[model samples]
Target: MSGLNSQRGVGLVEVLVAVLLLSVAVLGFSALQMRAITATDESLVRTRSLTLVRNLAEVMRAYPEAYVTGSGATFTTVLPTIASAVPTVQAIATSIAIAEADSGDSVTIDGLIISINGANNCLSTGTTTDDDDNEIPNKLCSINQLAARDTLLVKKTALEEDIKLAVVSCPADATQQAIQQQMCIITAWNDTKALIDDTDTKACANSDGVYKIGSHCLISEAY
Candidate 1:
């Protein structure tokens, strides 16, 4: 009878050990699942960012004229290359997009679409004259041009604190001269993680908009 009682006690201990191991396995699996979901979400956000970058580049390529001349105040002026991609430009575009998306916010703000010279603003605002400007002859809208048309939110996408269009100039042979400029564009977004770490960033005193830390993605292209 004593031996049988001892054997029953050992059997109960074995069963409890097995249950604990199973629980541990289940917890590990749950943790892995959560990690996978986080990775996927990050990937999705990155993809969207890339798409936005590409889209802006294409837009720039199409309208090289808009970025020429006028302190960028009148149009997307072609100031000396400060950096590729202007922070203010990216911020204004994103803000305008979001505002347009939100029904309630749409009315209070002037629409992103603006009229130039009292005319509906085309993707290209004015033309680079065939004779004086480069032969491309396509025109760009200047800041003053937009003003002539309507009130704008950001006036040539300029910001007091947050804007610098990085550009690199290299000596060009004949073909290179045609595509002489490498322009930089930065796509910046508010980084919650960065904001959380330094709460004082809420002020953004140095920058006109939120400081996203490394959240900006800059792309430069010669066209």
Candidate 2:
């Protein structure tokens, strides 16, 4: 009987040990799963930001005359408000509310033009001459800029909850001719704002325009 009792105690100890090991394994797996989820979210947002940046860049290239003024020789400063770039300006437009009527439903929101700096519409009456001295309407001359503006506004309105955009000049100061041609299209999501054209210690980008550690932002240099 004594031998039997000793055997039973040993069995109980072994069972407790197994349970403890199992609990630790389960906890480790949970931690790994959480980390994977966080990483996936980060990657998804970065991809979306890249897409938005590329789209805007292409649009700007298409609208070569859009940013130029004064006989189409000088570049117009698009971003008049420097301070508004860092903390993103909140733009308001007609709101569209969509409710899920059933599974596999489709929703479309019509474009509501948002004016920047109280600028006139592209279709407004204005004309400029091309290199060949061909008379061009303002709509044709600045179509690229208009397209870019429309794209930014529409994307902002649709993805307002997911992302923020600031179309700022690259050098911020635009002092030099080489740097004056570049523009910075910054897209940020979830607690990350790209560094403005300044040397702020807490900003995402450094003086060299490189992304710093722990800054959640994607900066694209557009010509």
Candidate 3:
């Protein structure tokens, strides 16, 4: 009788151990599944953000005239509205701001800003010439036609640099030109530090907006 009782007790212990092990395995799987779901959600958000940015860029490119001449104050488009499964599509705008730098006849091209609700304000600084002229021609002429061509070159460089820096930092993810413009501003600030030492004012005059150590043009506007 004593031996039979001992065997029964041992079987019960074994069964309890098996149940505990199974519970641990189940919990581990649940944790892994949750992590995977979270990762997928993050990826979807990033993709949506990129798509929104690209759409705005395309819209801006399509209306070059509107962008250049600064015709209408605002441009708007309706995105395809989707259910909760995906992000709500939104129309975005590429805002262009041009501003004159502290020194030099060069102009800066600030990058674009994107909005989700289509109610965001985009402010851009006006571009100025060496003569302190704020009128930026719709079409840039050759150096012979107008000395402002050099300023345009500098502006273009600043815009391109902003894009490149953003691409490097984010890799596959797309970012609005706003961030890139900010980076260019910092770069421009650093470049201007040595301007006081230079006596030659003709260095960046006729050439394109490429900024060298001694001879550099400031970017006045971004499109």
**Which candidate leads in lDDT?**
2
Q: Kindly list the per-residue Cα lDDT of model 3 for residues 97-155, writing each as its tens digit.
A: 22333222222112222221122222223443546666753432221112122222333
For all the candidates, what are their Cα RMSDs to the real structure? Answer: 10.7, 10.0, 20.0
Question: Each model's C-alpha lDDT?
Answer: 0.38, 0.51, 0.31
Task: Judge candidate 3 against the unseen true structure and give its global Cα lDDT, from 0 to 1.
Answer: 0.31
Superposition-based RMSD of candidate 3 using all C-alpha atoms, in angstroms: 20.0
Considering TM-score, where higher is better, how would the candidates rank from best to worst?
Answer: 2, 1, 3
State the lDDT of candidate 2 residue by residue for 1-223, as single tens digits: 9978766645777889999999999999999999999999999888888877776666556544332222111123333234322111111111222122121111111122323223433345777889999997755324433643455454553264466566655554444332125767777676665456345655657666777677778877777
Find the 10 residues in a row with the least total lDDT in model 3. Answer: 84-93
lDDT of 1 by residue, 1-223 (tens): 9978766645777889999999999999999999999778667655654555465555545444332222222224333353333322322333333223112221111223343222345345344546566646344434423332222233223222133222222123112212224544343333322111234543222223334444433333435
- Which pairs of residues clash in candidate 2, taking residues 3 or more apart in a chain or in different chains? 63-144
Query: What local lDDT score does residue 18 receive in model 1, on the 0 to 100 scale?
Result: 97
Return the lDDT, model 2, position 165: 66
Selected candidate, larger TM-score, 2 vs 3: 2
lDDT of 2: 0.51
Error of 1 at 62 (Å): 0.4
- Angstrom error of the Cα, residue 22, model 1: value is 1.7
Which residue ranges in model 1 land beyond 4 Å of their true spot?
9-12, 68-180, 188-223
